[model samples]
Target: MPKLLMIAGLVLLLVGMAWQFIGRLPGDFVFKKGNVTFYFPIVTSIIVSVVLSVIFYFIGRFR
Candidate 1:
């Protein structure tokens, strides 16, 4: 559990550091009307989900 938490923390840290460079991924939605702007990261969410799924699969396999 401790190791999993540590790895998760590290992954989050790296993502935070690289967030500016990543900006918005392709297929993400952005709406702008006058002064209102909305953003939804659909592609980013799917990528994150897949990556986490693979990580957990490996962790579970090893355990």
Candidate 2:
């Protein structure tokens, strides 16, 4: 179950990356509101990966 969750998380991250890459925003093709800009989709991906991993880790540990 743990392995399955890890795989699913990885898949989700990959899908998000692809979607970000393929999709475009308005005007300057930006995806930011203020202060920061988003040119790389990998950062969000890493965050997702970390969150998923943590959640899955705890789930596995508890079970």
Candidate 3:
């Protein structure tokens, strides 16, 4: 892939993630009421990864 396209793909990936979550994201917390706790990024990033992968995949195919 060209440098420009590679850069654009990265930019798009960042934008997609930031756009959906951003400040709206909730902070991490734990629940001990039932002696159970969990930790994770509430704002899922799988979509961002998928989109970026797809974009790059096509970019590679076109090259």
Candidate 4:
């Protein structure tokens, strides 16, 4: 449906904006060695999870 598409688009836009802010959070790990690299976003994942949980909790509470 058109409404669903619009909501999805909005969510994508918000996520893209938020990605720039969240991508470099502390406790996120990165390791590099000659010809090899590794990256993890542990802190970023936790922050996002907490944020989304709060948002949904409020939405559900109100509904």
Off by over 4 Å in 4: 1-9
Q: Return the TM-score for each candidate structure.
A: 0.78, 0.39, 0.43, 0.71
Model 4: colliding residue pairs = none
**TM-score, predicted candidate 2 vs. hidden true structure:** 0.39
Q: How much is the lDDT of residue 50 in candidate 3?
A: 73
The segments of candidate 3 whose C-alpha lies over 4 angstroms from its true place after superposition are 1-43
The superposed Cα distance between candidate 4 and the true structure at residue 32, in angstroms, equals 0.7
Candidate 1 local accuracy as lDDT? 0.84
| Reference-based TM-score, model 4 | 0.71
Model 2, range 1-63, lDDT digits (tens) per residue?
787878778777876776677564333334676888776546555655787788679867986
lDDT for 61 (candidate 4): 85
User: For residue 15, what is the lDDT in candidate 3?
Assistant: 77
> Model 3: which ten-residue window has the lowest total lDDT?
22-31
The 10-residue segment of model 1 with minimum total lDDT is 14-23
lDDT on C-alpha atoms for all candidate structures: 0.84, 0.66, 0.65, 0.77
Of candidate 2, the 10-residue stretch with the lowest lDDT total is 22-31
Return the clash pairs for model 3, or none: none
Mind giving the per-residue lDDT tens digits that candidate 4 earns over 1-63?
786577558766877799997668779899999988898989888877787777668756875
Q: Runs in model 1 with CA error above 4 Å?
A: none
- Could you arrange the candidates by lDDT from highest to lowest? 1, 4, 2, 3
